[model samples]
Target: MTIFHKLVSRFLISPEKKNEIGFCTDLDDILRDDGKVTLKIDGNKITLDLSNLHERRYAACLSTSLRYPQYDIDNLLMAKFVRKGDRILDGGANIGLTALHFLHFGASFVECVEALPWLAERIREIDDIRISVTEAALSKRSDGFVDIAISKTHNQGSTYDSSVIAKFSHIFGDDIKFLTTPTITIDSLTSGPFDIWKLDVEGAEIDVVNGALQSLKDCPPRVIFTEFWDERVHKFASVVSASHPVAYRAGITKDNYQLELLDMKTFEKNSEVFFPISPTYVFLREDCKEI
Candidate 1:
């Protein structure tokens, strides 16, 4: 075991340390190296093997697993909305975690859209079944280059990474060196119906949605999962609950694209913050009946 793992183990076994102390070490072992880790979620046993993958962002995976006990990437993949032989779209598919999750859940085909070449290359390394990795940003326009502020760290995909943002600006030096490859609208790239659609494009959720308006209207998926932060965007659809106090919406909408307000929950400051935003809502399509 690595020194980090040993340290974590020591913390975990310490009588004075809290129960949460050593948990991350165990998670590190599962993520950094190949091993079988069993997670008891919702009274059910789910086993994961990370033997073939590289060790990056293992902590985020572990944190996400602990935070959303019932809604891990695996659970989201196995969700009723996802099925075998179904086509799924993963926008801002950072490191292919969600894509891998969907693949594990049995998605026949997954189209992963990523803008950054560095992250896209990592996704390309994942050789799995029926997975297509696209290194392009999805926007409303047919084709054009956009400024994509890259993050040095794996988990920091947002444009707000303070250190990276400063470094990027300095490196580019008033020029467009930080600008990434060309971006394409979903309408221009996709040709057929899609089963599931997930968008986690930081703050550009609206632009991505606008780009795929045609597909959403024509071949509306059973579920549309997008991250929303600013309340202004909520006006476009209905304001579902936010994920955390400062996190975006995990809200669900109906088939007609109207926001569903039922079962809405408010956020409390003292409560555990899972997402970086508030009251993450899940939007379900109106036409989609619960499965």
Candidate 2:
């Protein structure tokens, strides 16, 4: 670190010693206002900017030049389903990273559905012509208010913070606040024979899919990618079967999902760990054979 950078770090830490212990101060100037950071992914460069008041969880991962834990997995899934002029549905698009990837790769249009207003605001900052950003939660009901949970780490979006459950009386705790926003069922909100659908709504993956049953049945997108965790895997699997039984007819077993590992260059290789305990799952429609 340069002397000037070190001095700045020292100054920021001196004020709140306890809170600033592990915080990075070298980039504080660049982060002066919460915003986007331009990054290079698999040799392709893109910019990510978000609301200044909200902290971006993926910022650290992107800024440190660390590969996104699920980037490889997502890429593999995208490779199978994405084609030129294909439409993609990106649920829980936090900061538009995944949407950016699809748009950059040649998807005709991407509809990003984000529940958090702040995060959606950040996505709107992108002047890209190929992507459409929507600020609404996908729910079973077409119109109603739902609890938009929030976590300490990523104040903009809701997250499951099991560790802090005991300390805080509520799941969201005082640090987070809930706002009633417009909600829509996936089918009602979008009219699509969309080529690909990606869902990553924390633990609410099933609920979001449940609301999109009609669309899934009608279009049966070539591929579906969602973040499934150990705790909710069974529920997610059940929802997949019930909602799109024909599309997932091979059965809900682990093998049917076909998880492939990815490298920095976006190359695919087989691995045991397909989903990071807190990772993303990419599912290919049974009818669409992989090339």
Candidate 3:
């Protein structure tokens, strides 16, 4: 590290104390020698790993507002759908930030599924009794393992689909690494009842949905929050239509965090411009009230 960075890291006010001051020091500037930063959020001490440039960048963005990109949507879900002691399933839970938030929002139990072993270890470090950590990729296969293509430079965008890796090669760069991780379908991992599920499995959303079909039928969740890319929306819509009858595109910008009920026909009609505006989606059963 540069001398300036070292000085900043040593002298800057600690992130855990940021709330008292109404703002946070940029995490990249205040990264510690241990490669972690502890921030107090909503009365809980949350520590994040910034050992890599990718996470450092992500932390820098989150430090500004003390929240992640999906903060608003999660708040909306809690306010509208979640009840006290609701069970949560956090798919692609990177380091358990959202899981912590779910606990803060009154979740009785949370199951976190993360593909990367290192990231899963970070989540396990929290050691919260209400949270359980699983270190495996959620894929179509219930038992075998799956290959993940992880970017050496930026690990957050790693996925089992090589096509997704190639599509975003410029962002991930040429420094890619491959590894095989154990797989568990959502249907198998979640045997009991669950209320809310937040899924963000990169480009493998369809795989997760496919694996959870039986569970979706037997034990339907109150809400399902996920992201949809234009390329994969059709198949995802087709597959999820059986269980979730209501769909809405969640607007993520600062000024517009509202949920717009989507008309599939209209969305497809304007797919050229509409699909790219917001990838966030909320799916609910017919009996559930729209949020």
Clashes of each: 30, 3, 0
lDDT by candidate, in order shown: 0.53, 0.58, 0.70
The CA-based lDDT of model 2 is what?
0.58
Which of the two candidates, 1 or 3, achieves a greater lDDT against the reference?
3
Off-target runs (Cα >4 Å) in candidate 3 are 1-35, 42-44, 50-71, 253-278
Cα shift from native, residue 33, model 1 (Å): 13
Whichever of 1 and 3 has more TM-score, that candidate is 3
> Judged by lDDT, which candidate is best?
3
* Model 1: per-residue Cα lDDT at residue 144: 84
Distance (Å) between predicted and true CA of 281, model 1?
3.4
Q: Give the CA lDDT, 0 to 100, for residue 48 in model 3.
A: 56
Expressed as tens digits, the lDDT of each residue in 152-269 for candidate 3 is 6554777887677877777566766678998888889853468988888888888988888888988888888887665586677678777787876654343333434456666555
TM-score comparison, 1 vs 2, better candidate: 2
| TM-score, per-candidate, Cα-based | 0.63, 0.66, 0.77
Q: What would you estimate as the lDDT of candidate 3?
A: 0.70
Model 3 worst lDDT window (10 residues):
19-28
> In model 2, how large is the Cα lDDT of residue 19?
53
